[model samples]
Target chain A: MDKKIKMRAEGVNFFYGRTQALKNVDILIHANQVTALIGPSGCGKSTFIRLFNRMNELVPDTSLSGNIYLDDLEINSAQIDPVEIRKRVGMVFQKPNPFPKSIFDNISYGLRVNGVRDANSIEERVEASLKKAAIWDEVKNRLNDSALKLSGGQQQRLCIARCLAVDTEVILFDEPCASLDPISTAKIEELILELKKDYTIVIVTHNMQQAARVSDYTGFFLLGELIEFGKTQDIFTAPQDKRTEAYITGRFG
Target chain B: MFTTLFFLGLIIFFVGVRGAKVISWEFLTQIPRCSMTQGGVAPAIVGTLYITLGAILFSLPLGVACAVYLCEYSPKGFMVNIIRISINNLAGVPSVVFGLFGLAVFVKFFGFGVSILSGSLTLGILALPLIISSTQEALLAVPQSIREASLSLGATKWETIKRIVLPAALPGILTGVILSIGRVAGETAPILFTAAAFYMRGYPKSVFSEVMALPYHIYALMTEGVHPDRQMAIAYGCSFILLFLVLSISGIAIIIRQKQRIQHG
Candidate 1:
């Protein structure tokens, strides 16, 4: 099936105290297409992504004026529970947070929390999710080992597997491989490419090549503004904006 | 210099061992009977257990509840700050001052009147500050990430605390309790004015019954026109038993803590 608009954000302005974190940001994330938000540190790429899942609400003294649509649901509405929104729009953190549990338990945690009681079903789902994360072969044997004992790369994959196990339709990653080694980063990049076939993926990263390599539609953000939003090939090769050109060409943030 | 220090330590070690050997197994099992001064300390042994157990039961719940309230529920406000400050000051007030307070409050007003109930209440108050401090430390040591992670996973705040936070902090809290037990086991001053009568020859039958702990027995046997050798022997035996009890409790606590840590880590 062709990619479709899975979620949308319209005319969103976000502030941390008096300082503006995001100017008017409008973007549409399509199903089964990896959209990477690329910018310098503190340029609102991460802040914009955090809006969709309401992770930004955790910050005290922060305010938002916007409308975020998760499929047909109004995610930004006061009536919606952020926790419920998070279940649908699963987030993988900057650091690999594997829950200090055994590998099997870490994957099953989301399912268990959502009241998935049948052991047989949980086992099958955990296995399928791990395979989707491309980590089942490496970790399947030591399923009972503590997640902390896994390598950083493995831990990141385990987190992806955790997100998948919850049966989320969309996945948000905030610098998911920023702390990993190049090899581990490459593995995660590969995993990301594989994941984009099934789930709507939104990622915020500082790495330009990663944005170039992994994304289908790329949104170039600068100074709390969306500078360019279009196909990745167009953004990387022939960006319309002068700022996007300067940024992708290794000039300045 | 090394030899001088070593020799002094050696002498002390040998002296302690000799005392322990002299105050051996027979001293532990037999109920204290002062042949003119109570050669054994069985009554003192029983009294110490009663007071210590009662004090622990009273203080543990109160202290932990206060700590959990402070850590989880209390906002940073004037009342909370004042209560915290008062607890800090209470810890610094002299034991003798606590003794006097116990005398005025429990002994005279409540009519507990030189009984284990009054003594236990006084000791519980003494141990409360220590328990609160340690429990606070333990609760703080639970990583904030764990709580955030739990909450993020759709677990209610109460569920997160019940399942994740409490089990993790349990070791530190137990360590604190065991340490307080050691201090409570050795206390004499506060109980002297509150519960310890002149000379309790046997174990107390009820909470209100006047009790004789090892420390009180030790104190009285040292004075009050008693037979010098037998009195001194009983004191030494009681001291040895008290030391063993404290050490054993601490040792067991450490072992359990280490086991839990290894299992978790």
Candidate 2:
């Protein structure tokens, strides 16, 4: 089977005011695969992922020079609306930031924003998305309850359900499990693998084990640079770059 | 906090004890008679209500919109900082200065005249800085992560603010409004030149009619009336009524904020 590219970034460079955060880099995210980015703190992994959905533009005084494509469409072009780009490429943050609203509203929010106002269809999509995120069984009876009342792990899954409700082609997880306990982390890892069969995923994580366990392709980043990129198995067992090997072997972060 | 509460209680008590005798049902319902020494402060009460309501109606939407624009859409840098500083400075400007501005602009230039329309516009201007600053604070308090979540789901910036950010910041915004109501009701200087009549016979016929307000009425009763002792008592009653009106308005706002908090939680 030939793998197709879902997203591609070419010669991407990013700066926050005077400080360069991402050096010239190239990466490809394959369709229906989990691509994990592993790096230490401040390695620009999060920055790179944010660019996939144009999330980096939210920060003031930040600029990017790159060709970022969702399939064949250049997302950074002036003709493309970031709002439209974001609908196609959703994001789940490190922290489970649920709106201080009811569980139903939280999931339906994306659909409503995308101009889906039919009550019956919204209800159907909400339930389908919740089930897809594997949180429906836990929250089925309390859809009207405040999303904040859910546990941290449940909230993270609800966030994922929120992304899924939008029917995004690519979902970016920026350290989605960084704040979760081991059990919650395991649940999210499982969900990611399950989600990959339907949606292309890009996750940034500090846990090498997580990257190795879930991702088909893994990219290792270091100090604003792409240090290595290959198949997860090859990158872990036979890293081509010494920096990637040293970091993977726990020589130094 | 106790000290503040004690002073508030003492002031209310001091006025209530003296004013209780004058505050009959007739005092609230009847028009003033006997050269402002007899009858009720009905016109003053009605006038104060109109002006305050009008001020809120004028300022709330404009202030909240300004705050939203400044916080969400404006490019963050020198220009925004300057605008922020100017708003803060506007808040610090004396009420009398606003009265003069109202006298010159809304009264003279716009030809609204010295009536409820002029006074309300004056008080609205006086309240704008407070409302804008409070609203800005409220908007800023909403977590950026929530905004990111909304935007990531394809919500436009306006949609995010209107649906999410504004609702979340509502309690804080109401707090600002509550404070402004208190100030707008009690303020004598802003309404003195632009709105308040010395003594009106009946309820204002329209926004064009000059009306008597509680604060200015109280001031008039003490200084302008012939019967000093009787007028002094009436003034106390007016003060008490004014206090009650401000409290009730703010009470309603507080209740709204409470409901919002409960619903959001």
Which regions in candidate 2 have their CA more than 4 angstroms from the true location? B1-3, B248-265
Clashes of each: 3, 0
Q: Per-residue lDDT tens digits of candidate 1, residues A36-60? A: 9999999999889888878776677
Interface RMSD of each: 2.4, 1.3
Which residue pairs in model 1 clash with each other? B33-B38, B34-B37, B34-B38
Per-residue C-alpha lDDT of model 1 across residues B1-265, encoded as one tens digit per residue? 9999998677557546755765756576566564535445667788888889989999999999899899877877899999899889878888877888889999999998888999998998999999999889988988876665555565556666766677678888998998889889888888999888656656688999988788887788677544777667666666667777887888877887786588556
- lDDT against true structure, model 2: 0.94
DockQ of each model vs. true complex: 0.35, 0.77
lDDT of 2 by residue, B201-238 (tens): 78999998899999999999888968998889999999
When only the first chain is scored, the TM-scores of the models are 0.98, 0.99
Where is the poorest 10-residue window by lDDT in model 2 chain A? Answer: A57-66
**What C-alpha lDDT do the candidate models reach, one value each?**
0.84, 0.94
State the TM-score of the second chain for every model.
Answer: 0.88, 0.94
- List the candidates' TM-scores in order: 0.85, 0.96
